[model samples]
Target: MNALQFIETSIEDGIGYIFLNRPKQLNALNRKMVREIVTSMEAFDLDPQVKVILLTGNGKAFSAGADIDEMANDNPINLELTNQFADWDRISLVKKPVIGAVKSFVFGGGFELALSCDFLIAASDTQFSFPEVTLGVMPGAGGTQRLTKLVGKMKALEWILSAERINAKTALQYGFINKIVAPELLMEESVDFARKIAKQPPLAVRLIKESVNKAVDLSLYEGMQFERKNFYILFASEDQKEGMKAFIEKRKPKFTGG
Candidate 1:
């Protein structure tokens, strides 16, 4: 794995952190940056040592959106050849739990990125929007599909069409962001939360995330069947046996991602 220029990555105590590093650009998603992000996610997801993946930015804004400067070219041939949006889609396929630690601005593509995560902990001052309508295009990523599934049709339509910004409070009220913390506590709280999740039985955690995500696209009956199958399969894992034994023994279970 080569060092990434557009993103900073580190793993500590079972948690992997991927920070958007282009502070000068408000951590905007460009081709290079998005590719680096997808690469980092793939690496972390495959690493048995990493139990959870935490994503955030190093600047005032999580990201202002896609690199509008590059979007201005409007070359369809170039866009297809680059396969830009496909790389962004790869983030969703990562099987590990992903948590978003957001602050300031999370707009357009940035908003979609956050939605891709299993959950998000955001700063109270965070501002989210999908301003692609104003750009004469729509969110080319999964924003339209994910946002509608998340916040309902009316709210999704209002935000996407109007391109208005919603503060963290509103976003939480609308059931998107999981929690809001003071800006100073953002990183600490997010990491602490990730660490707590990292302490869980790894196989159970991954299956839980996978099952819930599948529920989004599946009918209630189908989803329940899938959930039941996953639940049954976990009983066959060593971690599950240890977890149950620990409960009976009144001790913390040491899970080795088995």
Candidate 2:
């Protein structure tokens, strides 16, 4: 927040962009870097201009993993006292649609960070893994929980326990990622997708995001109840009326986030 040493934030059109800045270290997430990312997203959530947030790394790899040098000498007491993993949870609290446009390597904490986004678009060459077991550590930042929900318990166990890297194609087949573009198309396709979402009815988009995320934590019946409540609540919004009216009129709906 104070100078953004580990990350860079920007706003373009209606998208809030966060670029992991430590390319030389493959954007390895240190405590400070993760904090910077969460703080930037918090700021963007408050800003009216930012309708969507796209996260990408500055260089080839999205992120290699956590900074080994920073935590190798740490103990459990210090770890709990620091509560580093808590920062990862903050990402889910963000209201807007968050899209991860990751490339090359996304491993360990990096893979956890990607899963924190509402969805991901990765490069065809990207390789994802939770290689923490190799280091005698395991994912501490919702990686186990989220990956299990997305890819199922068996696949999660296969990948995490085996410490095997998952290619983009296999990841898409498992439904862990939304899409895979060529390495050259990663940014362009990411922005194109973000821009399309940005043009939608903002309030509806926000509510639907909340509803879908609830599907992950709530039982099927409870999730449907939540979705129904949101659907009814949208009837009170001006955009809801405009969207329907525009449909009847066969014209584009103009949304003002009302």
Candidate 3:
């Protein structure tokens, strides 16, 4: 499906590709652009053909962050009307797994967007930071919360306070990014990896995503209960029965997402 502007979306091999298409602006996200991205993601989440999503950008940068020009001219009325970050919040509600293929700069809002993804595979030279502090503001999206949860409180504090840009290697060491590849191979590697994930049972995959994401907000015991319930629910799916039967029969299981 085509978004009105800023997003280019396509589906292939069970993988949905969501591209930030504002190359001239380094894919900087204005409100409209952010809305397009959220809308595309929600659409992909509901598309039975799409089991995974690959989010990336089409330019020197994955995204420079929010459109500073748009923010600069905002009045109280327009700011209230825009809802600031209400649309961006919808990204986390996506049930399908979203993998971020990040290159160049992923700053402020861009970093927040990447953090919303289930995992991030970045180019070796990718640089990440939260530069909003420099703008006399702070990350208005999920950056502060998600980054802190991923990298821990001390590191998140340091990064956000200093607005220091870290290379992919450093990000990997900090446990923020999953993998790093050559710039030329970023898309190929990311899509290949996502396709692998797409091969899994779709129902189980969605439940697993929900179970794991709940850990951040739930206590250990509560998280375990949530996991157990999802585990029990999966047994009702035909895929689960087929998977077990296939294992006993020494054959591959064909999942129908039921």
Candidate 4:
């Protein structure tokens, strides 16, 4: 596997973990880090051995947002650079699920990165915000859109406009994060959760994620049609038959991701 200077990638027990390694800068997302992350995710997506992905950071923060030093420079931000923010979007669209284990700070691009994941397990000490307004800019990534989908439009607007840091408890209340554990146990619990997911039928999980994500933006009729299509498609898959037969035989299904 190719090494990422700003990140670390490893696969164990079918769970692929991509850790932000820039502890010195609080794991802030800069051009290099973002590029590295994109590369890592793409590698994981292509690796059929990887059933799930877990994203986290190594330092005191999950990520302190974008690197302010880059933004402070006089160099113009080009369309290509701005488009790099879609890395998380591509991760979100991957067939395998990505889980975000957040701790410390998750702000700006960091927040969006977590939001891209299908599931989020945050530490109790996690602090989230959309502080781009304070930076004299707005979220150039999918923050504006993804935030509103995770939370409501009003709450998303409040967080962005007020630039208030929300604690993990408040975030859970608003449904921004799925679960919160102690900071000390964040990684352990995240890996445990990913393992549970990995134990399930891979093809089923992939179809479920695809159907749910697509259903959200689609109309009721369209959503139902989409679900029907996926349901039948999966029904014909070898994994589906094996899953049913295994249940009948009172044994755990050994899915080959067929």
TM per candidate comes to 0.97, 0.98, 0.97, 0.94
Q: Which residue segments of model 3 deviate by more than 4 Å? A: 1-3, 75-78
Candidate 1 deviant stretches above 4 angstroms: none
Q: For model 1, name the residue pairs that clash.
A: none
lDDT of 3 by residue, 23-98 (tens): 9998998888888888899999999999999999998999989999888867779878868578877888999999
lDDT per residue, candidate 4, 1-258, as tens digits? 455788988899999999999989889898778878777777888888788989999989999899887877634567466666566666666778899999999988898888888899999999999899997888978888989987888999998999999999999999978999999999999999999999888888988999999876999999999999999999888899998999999998888888
Cα lDDT of model 1 by residue, 114-135, tens digit: 9989989999999999999987
Candidate 2 stretches greater than 4 Å from native: none
Number of the top-ranking candidate, with TM-score as the measure: 2
Give the higher-TM-score candidate: 1 or 2: 2
lDDT of 2 by residue, 1-258 (tens): 479999999999999999999999999999999999999999999999999999999998999999999999999999999999888889989999999999999999999999999879999999999999999989999988999998789999999999999999999999989999999999999999999999998999999999999998999999999999999999999999999999999999888888
* Off by more than 4 A, model 4: 74-82
Better of 2 and 3 by TM-score: 2
How many clashing residue pairs appear in each of the predictions shown? 0, 0, 0, 0
Better of 3 and 4 by lDDT: 3
Clashing pairs in 2: none
Winning candidate number (lDDT): 2
